[model samples]
Target: MDEDDVSVLVASLLRGDRRALARLITLVENRPRLRDRIMSLIYPYTGNAYVIGITGSPGSGKSTLVDKLTGELRTRGKTVGIIAIDPTSPFTGGAILGDRIRMLSKSTDEGVFIRSMSTRGSLGGLSRAAYDAIALLDAFGKDFVIVETVGTGQAEVDIVDAAYTSIVVVTPDMGDEIQAIKAGILEIADIFVVNKADLENVEATVMALQMMLDLSDKGDWRPPIIKTVATKGVGIKELLDAIERHRAYICETDRIEKMHYKRSKVRILEIVRSKLMDKLIRELENSGELDRIVKCVVEKKMDPYSAADEILRKLDKK
Candidate 1:
């Protein structure tokens, strides 16, 4: 699309047009060339939405919990935007398990907007376009934006960078006690949720989490462990309450400002690194230098580090 077309969409989005918002998100995701213009247009309207991240291991009922949480948020007269990151399809490279299908109940709600994205070979449990999508939702005037990461256990810590309140969900059967001690996931949670509370060993799971929290130096705010049965819409309100308390704590202490500064630093550096790498790879491929380097490495003529340095040197010369 042209610059004028993008301007029109941004205008529509600012007027709370859901179709325009969807179109803009798709444009940002698929057409990276237009991302800078689109983001610049919408950046001024963002920072109004509160972002919440829900992350956990596979089969932790995270989707069900998010569904319930969105319902509750709507009841409280809040417009909610959900970004569910799903695994990438090997064949099409699209989202394999469509979260929008799972959240069909909210499909018709005007106040609730849902979008599913594929991890697309990106790590840390989120799609590469996730940050951009969040910005679009925030700019579209949602009161709350919820990001549910692909359930990949440890690597999901990246959610902390994107959310003001980060929730880590676990189940009674997941052997989470051991998982907590081993993974960095435990360190990032603002709230720990033991979903499937009706199952056996629920107390054990809670105790394990409690023990871990006691051992860690959480400073002034300690993570609360809440038991939930998300399939039955249980403990969802309490979870939301916990989230609100954390939100209040951060706001009162002015830690939110610190978080925003840190996230901005990380986001800018990541974008710069990604853009530089993409440009370098394109240049190497077009000039056949990448192939020549690979051939030399294969034949043991040059080491990999030397090959990399040669590529950088050539780029510097150009």
Candidate 2:
């Protein structure tokens, strides 16, 4: 599509055309050249939606929970946008669980927009395009935006930086899964959900999470542990209430302002780092400097660190 077409589509999106919004997301995801322009156009319109990040191990019922939450939000007259990040196929670069076959019920709802994104081999358990996608959804005027990250272990805590509220879901009989939680996931959660609560040992799982929470010092806010059966929609209302309460607490205590400042600082640094790397690589490739450095390193004429330093020096000169 040309510039005129893109502008028309952006206008349509701002007018609440879901199809136009989908097309704009696709354009931003596939075309790097259009991302900055599109984000610049939409930046001012964002920050209105409440962003929620949900993450857990595979088969922890995150999709079902999100589906139920969307229903609850819609009943309250709120529009929703969901971004489910699925693992990417190493060979195909497509989502292994793309389209979330189980969420068909919400697909036709005009007020709810669902998108499935491949992690695309990003080790952070989020797609690089996830931030841009959230911005688009917020700018499109969704009252709530939920980002369900790739099923992750303890190390993939990037969601904490991306969302206003971060929920970590676990299940009964987790056995070793509890250790994974304690390793790093515990520090990032603002709420914990013991999903599949009907199963045996549910109390033990809840107890374990509560015990961990007790040991931590979160100032005036304590992360609530809610029991839920996503498949049956049991305790969903309570879960929603917990989310709202946390949001209210954060607002009352001014934690929201601190989060906004942190997010802005992190995002700007990320953009600068990415842009500098791209510029340096392109310049080196075009000038044959990259090949020369590679040859020198291969022939033992210069060490890798020295080669990198030479590149940086050249970059500084330019």
Model 1, 1-318: lDDT tens per residue? 798999999999999999999999999888888888999999999999999998887668888889899999998999999988776568744434654456547878999999887677564445558889999999999999999875554337777888999998888888844554434766788999999999999998888888788888889999999999998999999999999999999999779889889989988888887889899999889989899999999999999999999988986887
The global C-alpha lDDT for each of the candidates, from Candidate 1 onward, is: 0.85, 0.83
lDDT by residue for model 2 over 18-81, one digit each (tens)?
9989988888888777777787777888999999999888778888999998888899899999
Candidate 1: deviation at residue 76, Å?
0.9
In model 2, how many backbone clashes occur? 0
Best by TM-score: 2
Name the Cα RMSD for model 2: 1.9
Model 1 whole-model lDDT (C-alpha atoms): 0.85
Q: What is the TM-score of candidate 1?
A: 0.93
